[model samples]
Target: MTDIGIVGAGAAAAAATYVIDGALPDASITVFEKSGGLCGRAATRRRGDVTYDYGANYLKDDDDRVVDLVSTFDDGLVEVAGDIHVFDRSGTVSEGRDADERKWTYRTGLTRLAKHLFGATDATVHRRTRVERIARSDGAWTLTDDDGGTRGPFDVLLLNPPAPQTATLLETADWDAAARDDLLAATRDVDYRTVWTAVLGYPFELDRPYYALVNTDKEHDVGWVAREECKPGHVPDGESVLVVQANHEWSVERYDADPARNVADLADHAAALLDDERLADPAWTDHQGWRYALPESGLRRGARTPAEDAGCYVLGDWVAGEARLHAAVRNGLDTGERIVHAR
Candidate 1:
């Protein structure tokens, strides 16, 4: 059996695994994920009766291939109900260029997208298993977790973490130094925009024409505010949930600040932007800080050759040259096809 190992069980990794499983049904696939959840930044959380997606927002149906892939799942898949409005740095809201593009998320949450993809595969996913080291030996790859547990000598290895985390793994990999160095440098070239997210819940309802309001000008402290209730089956009747994301500068500044303070501050920003004082005092709140939230740039394609030749593949939004969920899935599909072709 061809042994395949994957690091990070994100959307891209799940897609790749799905494709690989379909093509090579007997391939033994193993995955290591550092977090408790399957999807990385395409995260979803539920508290009581409220479900919200606080990171990466909705998955846009931009790529036909990704659209076709997700449609096949068909379970719990949902369309975000309203259009996206825009706001200025001064907090003036207006009608945005409501493009006809379809925006999607699962009724359960965006995380269900990854769950559906991975669920269809035969791959074994190890959640909360942090891989600390990678080594190449005897024409195979091996991984050691933080707990000192070792997994395989796999024939192929796929990395799906953010560029920085992937680079860290490459930095100390016991492989051909030159090849590893080249791949490491390429991974390092990717830069990210941090995001501080606050999920605000209220006991009442929020009636708005648009599902979300985005800052057209990047100068605003808050970057995006989305209503979770816009997605069906997410928020229960008469209860509103808002996912507020702070801009890169503001996120970087207060990333380590007190969580309560940061949540209150973002709630204040939301209150001003929405022109509702009641929003400033959310009945309940949750927060998350994404240090490598969005990639500002993609990795250079040529930099991947040496590593791929060594039986290692990298797939993610950064490698796909776009920071969208669809891009990540598309990249995963293409990468899986490439691996199948190589085999």
Candidate 2:
């Protein structure tokens, strides 16, 4: 029987382990991941000889905890000077001081960051395990898998799943009326926007700026166009990779449409913005949808009832601030510290 059981293998869970291990050295830790791999939204995909960051793009230096954690890894990350180009609806590219701020990305891909977090600890990470329900019985917490298999009577249980999915899990578990109401109340007001990322790879370079942050008045959206070659180890000398993020409004309008057609249309729109018609055709192209891409509101109140008296905690970017990668990591570290202090 493990002392602590965590749901999800994202940064939050990894940070929780880092905290719990130090606080409760004798306790065993186990993390259950629904997917076949770790890194929930921080996903990376490889195409032929190039790797693409399909999920998170980069991290800000202002995030202290995140910076410290990332520094622990030896992966090559080039410092990005804010020399970004912001294109408005009129096709006017404005140059500003905002481009001078520093950012960072992996030389290979975002997966290197996930692997670094996982390597920091010895937590028992179980991939491909879908946690269906979490309940407290006989003074201990029981987590059930999809097949109704009971995992254990864990002393503590931490839930870090996305807010929408977390609501479903809380509904299945037996809890006091007030506790359930509080959990529901805290999450009810939180809304999220969906993001559609269209990734494409080409054998030739488009002789424009490396990054184009576009604001479209027609769609009232923000599209982030990044040159993959700007990062290290992405492609060969002449080839380049590009990623376009559709604005919230545009993504919502076509959230349920055919993915291929949606990607084609988005690619066309992006190509028009860049004045490069060649982008319509690429050697490789794909689209990924993020349902809960950004958090609408911050978490209302602290203190979540963790499976009866098991003393589990809840934390995520929603609780800290926006749904940025840095915020998530900060929330995770904070949750870990709180758990440790409680112990």
Global CA lDDT computed for model 2 = 0.73
Question: In order, how many clashes per candidate?
Answer: 0, 2
Report the C-alpha displacement of residue 261, candidate 1, in angstroms.
0.5
CA deviation > 4 Å runs, candidate 1: none
Please provide, for model 2 over 74-155, each residue's C-alpha lDDT reduced to its tens digit, 9 standing for 90 to 100. Answer: 5687664335777776655565335555667776676666567767676788888999998876656789998889987787
Question: What ranges in model 2 sit over 4 Å off?
Answer: 89-91, 214-218, 303-310
> Which 10-residue window of candidate 2 scores lowest in summed lDDT?
301-310
Best by lDDT: 1
**Candidate 1 TM-score to native:** 0.98
Q: What are the models' TM-scores?
A: 0.98, 0.91
Per-residue alpha-carbon lDDT of candidate 1 for residues 222-303, written as tens digits (9 for 90 to 100):
9999999999999999999999999999999999999999999999999999999999999999999999999999988788
